[model samples]
Target chain A: PDEGAMAQARELQGRLTKPAGSLGRLEELSIRLAGLARTCPPPPVDPAAVAVFAGDHGVHAQGVTPWPREVTAQMVHNFVTGGAVVNAFARQVGASVTVVDVGVAVELPPSPHLLDRKVREGTRDMTVETAMTRDEAIRAIEVGIEVADRLLDAGAHTLITGDMGIANTTPSAALIAAFTGADPGVVTGLGTGIDSETHHRKVEVIRAALALHRPSPQDPIGVLACVGGLEHAAITGFILRAAARRHPVILDGVIACSAALVAAAIAPESVTAMVAGHLSVEPGAAAALAHLDLSPLLDLGLRLGEGTGAVLALPIVASAVRALHEVATFDTAGVTDA
Target chain B: PDEGAMAQARELQGRLTKPAGSLGRLEELSIRLAGLARTCPPPPVDPAAVAVFAGDHGVHAQGVTPWPREVTAQMVHNFVTGGAVVNAFARQVGASVTVVDVGVAVELPPSPHLLDRKVREGTRDMTVETAMTRDEAIRAIEVGIEVADRLLDAGAHTLITGDMGIANTTPSAALIAAFTGADPGVVTGLGTGIDSETHHRKVEVIRAALALHRPSPQDPIGVLACVGGLEHAAITGFILRAAARRHPVILDGVIACSAALVAAAIAPESVTAMVAGHLSVEPGAAAALAHLDLSPLLDLGLRLGEGTGAVLALPIVASAVRALHEVATFDTAGVTDA
Candidate 1:
């Protein structure tokens, strides 16, 4: 029945008063809406929520990004204070933003916008030990599900997944390599503009971590524990919850993409709600996207790790949904055949 | 004085959040805003007006597009009835759409959204004679100026250029070849999905038109009269008026890009207010963007000519402007620099 609903939505989109298949991803969004709502003209859905998961990685000790771990909490402060780029974009698009401290080391002040769901103060040093235990991974995923349910009950029709973690890309690259069977050298890049020599060192660090853990793909949570940041696990859980609720979810950059890969492994249907916002310049991002068979809308070679790319892309998603709902059909307009 | 303002805007964008040179065309938009408003931070620009210029070409008898000329009127009706994709996108983004009958064969009924500004029923066959007279060209330009002024008075801070003329790509090819000094074979392509054989025929038609009228780039208006649609002339005039009034203008597709070339010829500063929405799939569009030194943001291989791309891109432009106005600097956030 859901498949039939999805097909009807796709047909209705094809019949919209424009060129057939012109809106691209927007067309898919409309079709998804049809299946979700089981109605030709779906009810108006808005009041979106963007959850930005923040964490820290012990890999920072290896000197990958120029910035330190302290900046994660500071940026989280900026996010909560409504001073970040994502905050501005959310305001412009009428979406609310919540910052979740999934694994930051510093303490956060109580605020309505801050969701204190930390799994650990910080991940274990992946270069020496697993980032976290498998049980911790489950806890992080539960954190994501709780966040999604809270936002869903708050009347958010769409969920946009965002993440903020320093040195998170190392774990992302590790997770991507394990999932896609790609070499760490091919999947990893300098996380935050490291020097050439530092980049070489970063690669060696990942190889060593992989050698120590020897994580298997059969257990995605084990792999996440070995290298994945807390935010990634939370995002994976959030995506699963969103898919269970049948709400559209927009994935941000590499960290979120890594989390999504793990989420999809847990529940394959979870990929149905995913929208790749843009192809991040991060090498892991492309690998994650390729593994998932998803295409990003924008490609400006952006490597900024915040939810900036996703925030910039929110309006385009809104346009796609709007196009599906609003454009008149050929029969209604009495136009000739395509 | 305008140049000074443009310089200031560029400088301000340079200091905004994110990398110095990142955001690509969005950075250019900020600079354009600076020049248009003659201020550092451009006015809170919104309430955009998209003028969808509708016209018919006598060259449609040459069989350029698959659709017939009657479709132009029907599409115009769709625009007025809010059934078009551009209409949906505009409504989503809170912009008003006005369809102008620059030169359609059929008379349009009186409608509040339809602008009865037809210079003639249709243009003369450019293969045989000039498409429009110099007097008609001037009147069309004046029509554009009047539309921009009225839109500005109506609290539209941004002016978006759109077109809906059937078989207009023939003239666009001719204009691009004449102005860019490129051979018609290089600038022309099969518009609206013509077969390979029909595409060859369309190229031959363009080559013949160029052979018939040797247009001078120095006299853009004369070149416009020699092979321009009423919609093209009006868009040129509209861009000029928008620039003069310091209203930001977003160029739609190839036709609008061709008109912008003429507008820039008349007033080079007019480029300051121009935002290239996408590098259209049309050969002329890429050539025109290169000639104008403008980089478009969205490039999804779109050739739909109803300003749908531009309307869809408005949210991004709004985000750039909002980012400039909202995002706090490193100093404000008191965060450590990368």
Candidate 2:
């Protein structure tokens, strides 16, 4: 991010016809976007790209959620055919959707807009063994970086995260607790609206896994490999690459929030280019966002994690930038200043 | 609102691919919109129309704000020329803007997209006398209803409220206090970034006006005539007409919210057809919204009040409806349901 551009944006906002600081968070958002674009009144955040990373979580075997693991592949097909929630929202915002198969348990048939970048079958049951090998986590992350490059090269000004992995919230809770040093019970939530009994079991599973691995937040990749899902690792790399390239990435729900914890841990400076799209009903999403010092744009109690929240917020992010680009200055409008 | 359509929408939402209650407020918003549209899935809120009613405030003579009263007429020109914040946001959401000269002090020139619907040359200073005669207030509201009819007849599926009036927040605070039984100090705020002295003076002005008029909330028209701007009276009529016709109307900042208070008082059932677009930084806006029991969709600290906040929220409103219309059902997508 360019400090010079941010300073210029702040100066520009003061000159806008509206009162100083009346736009509130939107004025700050525009300044941040200006810094990211390296110019005052940053370019429009159009032609946004959504990468829905699909995987299977071995924790499903532990009954963390009622949804079956095979549903992961089913959702991948749903996303590819444009029948999923993410697809509907993407269409609404004119953003293209791509499905990244980081690690699905079953073999997936190839299709357009589906990138087959499976690292392995699926992460191991974390309560019994490590989620994945360190090398496998790195490979999955590389897949995300490559996807970010592809999306940016194809003319996407903004990158949005989406995920479809049943029982993935188990790993997300574990990762958030690990990075933020919060209690497992505090970070875990009822993923997909689980019963109270299953929710307790889910929290217990996360606590046990964290106790077993004791993954240090200082080593983000090690923490990811030990307890994080392939999609989480991939999203971490996606965030890192977006920040490295000075483009904005809108994070979706708890899944993306946990992944952002890993991305921030690996590259602290990358946090500048990240935007919390919405506060999910999942408690871990809020915990991660609070830890990152980012305030979400929307709070609709959304817990579905297919980038639906991020896509819904695309218009808001664009509007913030558009304000800087299009609003007339007080002098130009010949209006009396307050 | 049609309870049958609302019930049908709730049932339809349960069948969506995502888990029940996962989309959260959006699910409820869609159901509410369905009831307003009287259908399972409401018609898209496209070709939305924004009516920016411009007026001058007699309260400006009370020295409530630093901005000159003439800025209201100047802003009317800025809105017509598409240089205001509301115009920028309207363009982003594909909503049309129409400036209505309901009570500008100066004789305005003819222009395209500008409606010459002046009821009077602004209102009388409420601290000294009634803001207007009761008959004049009723005429202003009639103007609002006529504008609503013209916009709806021209194919606008959604109506957005906008206002351009200097020192309008002084009257807004009085209206909110009169209707909600709130303290003047609690409802009054610094409009357009007034200094501490001006803010204190503004609150005193509201308190003095409320004391002088002692307006009755039961008689909404009389209250408007005593302590409301022409834009406020007109917006009340606009909201009433939209509710009478079973169409949704998005209310903007403090002025619109104050008008909504009068509208809801006149026709309590009209609350069913209203949507609070954004929570304005203006204290009166939130007080009025709370009294109306409408939760704002966006809260970006926007106090621009040219329907900017409402225009920015158009996407969220549209997306809520689109989710119900487009998202695949669990059975259709062949995914395991929770």
Candidate 3:
């Protein structure tokens, strides 16, 4: 992103009809987009694609949630069939969605929209063993980078991160605590309407894993290999790739935010490409986004994580950019500001 | 809205995949829309119309703001030509905009999209005399009701309130002070970048108007006739008509909020029909929303009042309704609770 273009965008904003800084963060966001696009007013961000990375968490065996592990694959099918909330939202905003089987435990049949990019069938239970081999973690990341590149090549100007892994928030909490140095209890949240007993067990399991692993925050991939889901690693890679390409990545929910913490650690500049789409109710999401200095566009108490938040934000994100190209300047309107 | 329909909507929400209250206010808004539509899932709130009420205030002679009074007519022309920020935003969200010259000081040459419903050529200086005769106030409100009915009859499922009167927020502040019983200095803002001295004078102007009128909180129209602009009176009628017809009315900025206070006082049930789109930095807007017990959808420090805030919120409001219609129930999706 160029400082020159950002300065030019701010100048243009000043010439609009409203008072200075009246548009607030939308003004800043539009300027940021201009800087990224290397133009005073960036090209329209259209033809958005949401990549829902599907995986399985071995931590489900710890009784962190009551949802069956197979529900992950079933919900992926729902996404494909355009029956999920994300599907409805994407349709409303005219964006497309794709599901990437990054590491789902089942060997599903091939589908047109489902990208088969499994690095491993599932991760090892973090309390028993490292979630994945370091090599497997790298493979998932490379898959994510490839996904971003392919989506861009196929004409997607904007990318959104989504994840599908039951009980994934357990490792998400641990990963955020390891990176942010927060206590497990502070970052842990009820993942999916868990009973009080299950919630306690979930937090304790994350604490046990962090104590057993002692993953270094400085070594992002090492942390992922030790206590992260494959989808998290891939989302980290996805965010990094978007930054490398100077494109925007709208992140959804706790898992994507945890992945962002890892991505930002590996490449501090990657946070520039990320837009916090919504502040998910999951406790770790706010902690992670706050550490990253990102404010979400929507906060609807949305707990669904299949890029639903990002999908809902598509029109808003696009409108902020669109105003740059479409709105009349005060000079053009023959109106003077106070 | 029917209580039976609201009860059915609540039951339907419980059957959805999320927990009972996981969606928070989005859930509440959806149920309200359902009750208004008399269905568990409301019909799509498509074909939204934003009525930008353009007028001029005679109070400009008092130097409440630095902008020229003719700028109101100029912005109306900007709106008619689809060149203003409101037009840009309305186009972005597939919503249409109409400029109602309810009391523009200048007579605009007829344009197809401009509603020439001028009740009078603005109003008298409120600090010196009544802003409008009681008969003129009622006429302006009736014009607003007609505008709402015409828009809805022309197939606009949702109505958004927009205002364009120079120095209008001055009267807005005075009216809010009269209704909410807040001090003039507390509710007054630099309407459009006034210096400290001008801001203080603006506060004094509102204070003088309130002291001279001593408007009753119980008689809402009396307040409008005393200190409100023609645009505010019309928007009040527009909101009341929408509520009577069971349509959602998205409110914008301090001027619209002030009008909504009038509407709510006249018909207390009208609050059910109102949706606060954004919280403007204008101190009076927050006070008005708080007094009305309404929470805004977005708060991006927006003070642009040509329906920009409400238009930016179109997609978000629509998605909340869409979720009720499209998201799969837990039993149908075969997904389990935590």
Candidate 2, B1-338: lDDT as tens digits: 78999999999989988889988888889999999889989998787899999899888999998888888988888898888888888887889998999999889989977999999998999999999899999999999999999999999999999998998989899999999999999998877888899888988888898889889999999999999999999999999999998889999999999999999999999998898999999988989999989999988888888898998888888888888888888888888776
The TM-score, computed over Cα atoms with residue i paired to residue i, of candidate 2 is 0.98
Highest TM-score model number: 2
Q: Each predicted complex: what DockQ?
A: 0.54, 0.79, 0.65
Candidate 1 deviant stretches above 4 angstroms: A1-3, A32-45, B1-28
Structure candidate 1, residue pairs in collision: none
Least lDDT summed over 10 consecutive residues: which range in candidate 3 chain A? A76-85
> Each candidate: fraction of true contacts kept?
0.49, 0.79, 0.66
The sequence of per-residue lDDT tens digits that candidate 1 reaches over residues B1-338 is: 36887787677655554445545555667667776787767776577889888888877777767877888898999999988988888887788998888888899898988989888987888888888888988888998998898889988988899888888888888888888888888888667667788788888877777678887999998889988888898899999998888778888888988899999888887887788887777889999889888888787667777887888777778877787788777777876767
Best by DockQ: 2
Residue B136 accuracy (lDDT) in model 2: 91
- Deviating ranges (above 4 Å) for candidate 2: none
Clashing pairs in 3: none
The residue-level lDDT of candidate 1 at A107 comes to: 86
TM-score of chain A of 1: 0.95
- What are the per-residue Cα lDDT tens digits for candidate 3 across B201-284? 899888888889889989889999999999999999999999999899999999999999999999998998898988888999
lDDT of 2 by residue, A1-338 (tens): 78999999999999988878888888999999999879988889887999999888888889999888888998999999998888888887789999999999999998976999999988999999899999999999999999999999999999999998999999999999999999999999998999999999999999999889999998999999999999999999999999998899999999999999999999988899998899999999999999999999988878999999999899889888888889888899988786
